[model samples]
Target: MRLSDGPVALRPLRMRDAQPWHDLRRENHTWLKPWEATRPVDETPEMSFANMVRRLRAEARAGRTMPFAITWSGTFIGQLTVSGITWGSLCGGHIGYWIDKGHAGRGVMPTAVALATDHALQTMGLHRVEICIRPENANSRRVVEKLGFREEGLRPAYLHIDGEWRDHLVYVITSEEIPGGLLNRWRATHGPLHA
Candidate 1:
């Protein structure tokens, strides 16, 4: 499935995206390093792009994840994924994303995130969606703030980022809170974008 509004779009990540994805990661190494998750030192080696795509696809098929490639003006720019979906009573998922440094502050990330969150709530039948942002990640925090997600609390050493565990500010929004939908709320609050 694909989700989009204005110039920002999110679609399933493809194997063909490997080269651009790798290049973007390389270019944004310094920009993204601090927020990127790191595996345990003793874990198995990192998987290749193809393997990663296969794994994500399998997860998507299992209804456990939604792996999407973020694009702006028809150009690939980043990635956003709604992962760790739980259905029993929780019926929620967590969102994680990264964008090229050049695309920051232009509303691209927020728009992409809003689209994904709305999809999770509406199409995926999820009740809640969570976004965990490192306390120091002002840009990411802004995305949630812009969407009016309530700050639940702080998670100490929540996830291993860069090289060590980091504290994250937990933000959450339930479907009932966004009855009009996240994209609609964003557009109403921020006005329509030219891009």
Candidate 2:
């Protein structure tokens, strides 16, 4: 919730978000289809919003994971979630997100990512965060590179994306990388922010 971007907030998904969520998801269908889990035949675009909210709430209440919807100016813009969490040895989860196509490149994801990452490290007590991206997705690569996530390696034929097996570039940023505070971390990774 404490992101640098004004009016951008993370809130639990709700049934009321159904319509806007459907519209946004349908808008980004082809764009996001490659990266997301396969869609089911029984579901229409309209039903997806309710499904998302239901799933997120169930997961949260079960202590399985945390899911957040990104909203700006009363519109459902996107979603970010931390999944596959492990309590011990790994203490990690994969970070996944997507923004409304119209709002891309607006500094939305970075602030949201930083805020989410801070919550993971400082609040959830997680150690490492992982991001797996298709090698060709330059925008996503920029996000990770800007955030100082080290490129671990490529896993060939790692994920089913866009109806085919695609290689994924694994990236990670540990809690130790943050050093002292958010500003320092941002400066260290992305250089000085211009006034």
Best by lDDT: 1
User: How close is each model in CA RMSD to the real structure?
Assistant: 1.0, 3.5
Q: Identify the leading candidate in terms of TM-score.
A: 1
Mind giving the per-residue lDDT tens digits that candidate 1 earns over 10-109?
9999899999999999999999998989985847888899999999999999999999999987789999999999999999999999999999998888
All candidates: TM-score:
0.97, 0.83
Q: What is the C-alpha lDDT of each candidate?
A: 0.92, 0.75
lDDT of candidate 2 over 32-126, digit per residue (tens): 87677543342656345567678777877775677888877656798888877777788887888898988777666766677677777778888
Q: Candidate 1 — what's its lDDT? A: 0.92
